[model samples]
Target: MLAVVVAVLVIYKANFPSYLYRYRLQISLSVDGQIYTGSSVIEVVWKCGPKIADSGRCGPTLDGQAAVIDLGSRGAVVATLRTGDTIYPVPHGAVDAVFICANAFGNRSTYEELPALPHLTGRRDLSPSNFPRLVWFSNPADMTSAQKITVENVANVIDSTARFTEAFVEITSDPVVMNIATKLPWFPALKLAQKGKGVLSMPGQFQLVYNMFVGESS
Candidate 1:
């Protein structure tokens, strides 16, 4: 009976984090005076373990702690690293390199709750003050000097005509969101793709909406 109980406890510890912390963030982008639209999906899988090395090795081996951002038809961004740490996904082909070098989680997770995007909560006016900063470079060579910019700047940096007139994000995960839930070491990588007239936002301007959902992952 003792051995059986121990085994069950270990199993529960290993599986609960994966069950409770996985999340999917869906984003839609639109520019002023444009009918076209852009979209991207970001999925983060959290696991119960020590930590993952940059080599993307070790730990659960399947569905490990990592962030995958799918930019629709454009391409994808993948990062396997410690939670809340910077995520560096190698850029390939036409995909420009994007790095969440700072404040990936917006607000840190505490013992009582998971990390939350406080800047996006009930925000009517979106600007650099509220949006997390990121770095983008067209040529990998420029990575050394790429300055941190708002998530909205990504679109304009890619194309001049493409400027984000408006944006919306939908995040679904276990427990509550915008407020808090479970905790983890780091969050996930954030990337954007273009489809409509332009990108998502400009520096210190416009608005980005958010809809947070708390539920079980199917």
Candidate 2:
């Protein structure tokens, strides 16, 4: 009976819908050795009901692609993504994980065989540079309901044919929070907000893609 009760509760919770999810992330990267690491804080906010779900708008959905290329050296382009934990279901409570990806170039047999450079400790919020900030929105027409911003920092190192660029982005504000109907029939409707950021490092060129999805009410 105890086991059956626990299983039933789990099933009940699974049906609940989370309308807003926010991610707080910090990342570091190095171009010389091709190393990247990051951590994230995930939040689940205000839930909505079937009426809103049927309308085809619910919560924020984020998706994008980024790449780093070194034009000076042949076969020196490496793009990687490392997430500490499985990012599904957006856990309701606080959870932490360590994420890192190592890329090997030249004669290196494998990423593990790459030599470590203790002297190449990556820096955060480095001096700004002329590197351009590029962003693409999946659905600009639908984003009229919410507010967004992008804060970026870049460091550039140039020597001979190679130029290394590292970038960090911070998004701190969203003025127009989404107000949606509640999933629970009794409680009044509530508000939901979402935000995101990213980091990248490369020897030649770097590109950052930002996408934001917002729910709207009629």
Candidate 3:
């Protein structure tokens, strides 16, 4: 009977829709055989439903891409915790598991991996670049009206994603982009925003938008 009750609860929870929960994060990266620190924001979108019957895999969906604040480099090796960083869930009672520890060049990592830079220590005790933020997981589809409103609690989340998508459409004339295009036409045309800046991208494609400080929001 105990097992049956747990199963039933899981089934009901599985029907819930997934949404992105915004959090303020602090992190450090192992860059160029040294450590760099920065403060940034992350968006962790939850999976809408529960585990598949036998897939043996269940969690927020993520691609190789992620957004980070990129705090330059540090002068010494330290294990200091970041200030004012948090991962508490909004609306309360949401369970979250941070994901990290990717290849340095892959360009992103997780906060959980710090305090014990195992990956770095493994490679002669350091690396050349690492990412330590878990921003923006892909939200599951097939949500109910209740689920829609749950995320709608904050208008900024929706607008944040919108600004990213629309950015690409207007980039041709964007001063920063235009300047980069003229100077380095072959580059990705992406840049890291200053601690107090923002990001922009093509319309409807929020994933492409990382924080950038150069342009005024349109």
Candidate 4:
């Protein structure tokens, strides 16, 4: 009886509350009015509990150069080369969802949280009610020499238009759930924020917008 009880306890500890979380977040980048869908992977590191960060790999990965933006307490933004002269801004923020790289440049980065555009809704199956849409921006022209230099040095231009906006979405939720959609295979856990409420399991498709800007590089 003692052995059986111990085995049962172990099984309960291992399987209770599901032991894993899942999320999926996506962002689209628009430049000069032309839109390009950005790709990213979410990474969850155990910091007390599950904390999510950008995989540091953005679509259009370029070969020679890299750019870094300081997000202050929020964290930092790292840009990597993808295609052409584009450097994609992959923002890293704190658990609180605040932008941390305040000192990385002189000019201020602009942000906007707007309803997701209709055509960009990629997931056809999920209902629209489950997700809330938002957008953010980091204009390139407004970027200081430090910001531009880091990005330019990278062989590819950071998708300055939509710098680290997608990652911001999942992190902003009251009870943040990273990658709620299984977009990335690795991070299959939801990231809860503020200890707000119980996990939410809703069915719907939601759209988000992230618009970034950078003046034509000199």
Give lDDT tens digits, candidate 4, residues 11-127: 764433111111223333334444444322222111121213622211111111112233322222333212112222222211110111111111111211111111121222211
Weakest ten-residue segment in model 3 by summed lDDT: 165-174
Model 1 TM-score, 2 decimals: 0.32
Predicted structure with the largest lDDT when compared to the true one = 1
Cα TM-score per model: 0.32, 0.20, 0.23, 0.23
**Candidate 1 Cα outliers beyond 4 Å, as residue runs:** 1-7, 10-19, 22-32, 49-107, 115-161, 173-218
Stretches off by above 4 angstroms in model 4 are 1-6, 10-18, 41-218
Model 4 Cα displacement at 13 (Å)?
Answer: 0.7
Cα lDDT tens digits for candidate 1, 1-218: 99999999888764443312332222233334343332223333333443345222111211122222333332322222211122243122111101121123342332122223322222132233323223322332222323333444655554444443443333333332321111111111111222223445444332211111111121
lDDT of 1: 0.29
Question: Per-residue CA lDDT of candidate 3, range 73-119, in tens?
Answer: 21111111111123333222221213222232131333222212222
The residue ranges of model 2 lying beyond 4 angstroms of the native Cα positions read: 1-28, 34-36, 52-57, 60-218
Clashes of each: 6, 0, 10, 41
C-alpha-based local distance difference test score of model 3: 0.26
Worst 10 residues of 2 by lDDT: 96-105
lDDT of 2 at 129: 26
